[model samples]
Target: MAVEILIVDDDPLIRQTLHQQLVALGYSPHVAEDRRSAEQQLARQEFALVILDLALPDTSGLALLKHWQEAGTSLPTIMISGTATIPDAVEALKLGAADFLVKPVDMFLLEATLKRVLAAQALRSENTRLKQLTRGGRVDFLGDSPCIRELLAQAERVAATEQTVLVEGETGTGKQVLARWIHARSGRADEPLLAVNCAAITETLFESELFGHEKGAFTGAGERKPGKLELVGRGTLFLDEVGELPLLCQAKLLTAVEDRVFERVGGTRQMRFEGRIIAATNRILSQEIGKGGFRRDLYYRLSAFAMRLPALREHADDIPLYIGQALERCRRQYGRTFEPPDDNTLRQLKANSWPGNVRELYHHVERIALLTDGPRIPRSLWLSFPTEPESEPTDIPTGDLRTAMTGFKRKYIQRVLARCGGNQTEAARQLGIERTHLNHLLAEYDGRR
Candidate 1:
C-alpha cells in the first residue's frame, strides 16, 4: 500500500505544493488547513506521517504536537515554520516531532525528509515487533511440579487485571522471563512491554533516565528526552531489581505510581503515565526498607500482587524438562544438533546445587554443546563439584589436600570469571557468593601467584 501523509498547514499554496510533491512521489497525501481539521482527519484515518506547520490559524502547531504526544500517538511527524528559530526547532523535536523544516521548503528536500522519517518509523516498528516475537517465542513452563503449576495459575489470574505486580526471586531465577510471560498473556499483550534494570543504572542518572529531562535542564541535556515511563504508555514497564532504586527516586516513583502524573526534569508541564508497572528484585525488600535503603510506602504500593519465583533447588524434579528445553534452544541458537547429556552427566548436574538457577543450567548446556567433540556430552567434561576442605584429591599427597583445594578453587573462580567477561559482580552472582568475598579470593590468588 502507498504510504499516507497528512499535511497540516494554514497557507493553501504551501499545502498544495506539498500535496503535489507527495502525490508525484507516489504517496497518498491528505491536507488540513487548521488544527481542528487535522485532528478530525487524524481521528478519521491513520496516517504514516504528518507534515505540520507551526503557525496555524486555530492553534500553534507546537500545541497540536504536544496534544498528540500526551495522547500517546505514535504517528511520525515533521514540523515546518516560515519564521523558524533554534528554540522552536528544539521544542518541536522535544514534543516528538520526527524532523523540522523551514518554510519556502525545497520540494526535493521535503520529499527526502518525509522518506527518511517514514523509513525510520518503519524500522522502529519492525524492531519492536522482533523484540516481541523473541520474548514471546519461548517454551511454556516446562514442569509439572506443584510449585510451577501454582505459579502458572497465579500468573494467569494476575494477567486478567491491570494491577501492579512485584516479582521476587534470586538472581537468575527467571523473574524477568516470568514477567514477560504474564505480559504476553495479558489483555495489553498487543502493546509494548519495556524492561529496565534499576540496579544497572547509575544513581546520578536514575531520575533523568526514568522521568526524562528537558533540553537545557542540565549541562549535557542537549535535547528534550522522553523517559521509559512516557514511552510505555498503556503498556507494561518491568523494573528489574527495584530494590536498587535510590531513595530520592523511590519517592518520586511512588508518586508517579500512585497519581500517574509526572513532569520532565526542568519542565513544568505535567505528563501522565498510563502504563502498568511490574517490579522485580532479588533482595528482600522488607529487609532493605528496615535498613533504610528502600521505602516502605513504595514497597506496599508495588506489592499489590506479589509473586515469588522458586529457586531451581525447590523443583529438582523439573531438571530433566528444563534440560530438554535448554538443549532445544541451544540447537536453534547454534544451528547444530546436540544429543542430550548422558545418564551420568545428568546425575552430576542434578546432584549439584544450581546457585544461578535456570540461567546457569542454560549456559552450562550451551557450554557443553559447544565444547563437546561429539553429539552427547560426557561426564568427563563436567565441572568438578566443590569438595570439602579436608577431602583429598585421589592423586594428591594427604598433606597437600589444602593446596589442591586452593588450586581447584582458583581454577573454578577463573573459569566463572572468564565466562562473565571478568565482571566480578556478575561472576559473584553466578557463583552465589558476595562480591566482597570474590574480591578477597582474587586478592589471595594474586598474592599467592
Candidate 2:
C-alpha cells in the first residue's frame, strides 16, 4: 500500500483541493469534514500522515493535535491555516506538529515537507518498521460461513496448546494468516512471528537457514548469522510450503524438531529451541509421501495438529462478507468507498466460482471498487464464468479396460472442472473423491499432456 494521508478540514474547497493534490502526487488521501470524522477515521485505520486545517467546525485543529501529543499517539502531522499569526505556528510546533504551513499551501513546499517529515520518522524508531507489517492490527476473520466458523473454533482450541501445527489448503487459502490467528491467541503472543519459505530456499542453504550457521560454515559463509528458529526466540516459527523442503534438509529438521535442539552449521555447540513450530503447505503431504517427495515421520511430527483452510467456492455464502471487507480495505488504503451490493448483486457474487480463493476475490473487488464511479456498483459489472460445452457420451473404444477407464476418468475430471469454472474442490465434490485425489489425477493428466 502507498502512504495514506488523512486531510481534516471544514472548508469543502480546501478538502477537495488537498485530496486531489495528494492523489496527483501518488499519495492515498482520505478526507474528514471535522474533528468527529477525523477521530472516526483514525480509530478505524492507520494513516501515514495527517494534513489538518487550523479551523474545524467542532473544535480547533490545534487542540486535536495537542490531544494526540498528550495521548502519546505517534503520527507525523502538518498543521495548515489561513489566518494564523507567527505565534500560532510556534504553538503548533510546540504541540508536536511536524510542520506548520500557511493556507494557500504551496504544492512544492507541502510535498517537500511531507518527504522530510516521513524520512525523519523512518530513522527515529523501530516502531516505524513494525507499522508496515501490522498496520491492520489484530486480524479477525470476517466471514461467518460454517467452514470459517468451524475453523475459528478449532483454532481457538489449538492456540491454547504448544503443539506443532501443519496447515493444508489450496494456494491463497490464507494458511499463513491462520498461523497468525493461532499465535495471536497463544501464550507467545507478545513474541515475534517469523516465517521461512521452504520451497524458495535452495537445498544447500535450507539447513543453515533453519538452524544458525557458524562463521566459515560453507563457501559463502563469511560470518555467523542467526536463523529464524533462533531469531523467533519464544515466538512462533512459520514454515510456509513445508512439503517442498528437500529430503536431506527434512531429515536434519526432524532430529532438531524431535529433540528440541540443533547444532549450528559447522559448529560443535548445540542450541535448544524453545519456540513453537507451525508449518503450512498447499500440497497434500500424504500424497507427497506416497510419491517419495516428503518424509513420513516429519509429516507425522508436523501433523500433530493439522487443519485445512476451505477454498472460497466451498464457502461461497460468505462472498458478500469478503467483498465488504475488500471494499473497506480499499476505503482505508486507497481512500475509495464503495456502496453495498444489492440483494441480486450479492446473489450473483455468491453463485460465481472463485477459483483463486479469497486472495483472488479480494483483488476482483478492489478492481471493481476502483472502476465504479457511481454510488452503487453496477449490477452488470459482475464476474462471469466461461461455460463449458455439453459433453456427449461416446461409444466404448476398442482399447483394453485399463486404458479405456484411464482416458474416461481424465476427460471426465477435465469436463467437470470446466463445468465448475475451473474450481477443483467443486469438481472433486461432484466426482465424490477427495480433493487431494483429484489433484493427483490432474497432476498425472498434466504430466502426460
Q: Candidate 2: what lDDT?
A: 0.85
Question: Candidate 2, 124: how far from true, in Å?
Answer: 18
Q: How accurate is candidate 1 locally (lDDT)?
A: 0.86
Over 1-449, each residue of candidate 2 has an lDDT whose tens digit, in order, gives 67999999999999899988898888999999999999999999999889999989999989999999989998999999999989899999999999999889889998888877876565444333433453446867667988899999999999999999999999988898889889888897777787899989998888788887877989888756667676676778899999888899899889988999988888898888988999999998998998899999999999999999999889988888887788888788767567878888788888777777888888787777777764577876655333458787675655899888988888888889988989998999999999999989999989987
Model 1 worst lDDT run, 10 consecutive residues = 130-139
lDDT of each: 0.86, 0.85
Model 2 residue 152 distance off true place after TM-score fit, in angstroms? 1.0
lDDT of 1 at 378: 69
Please, what is the TM-score per model? 0.61, 0.58
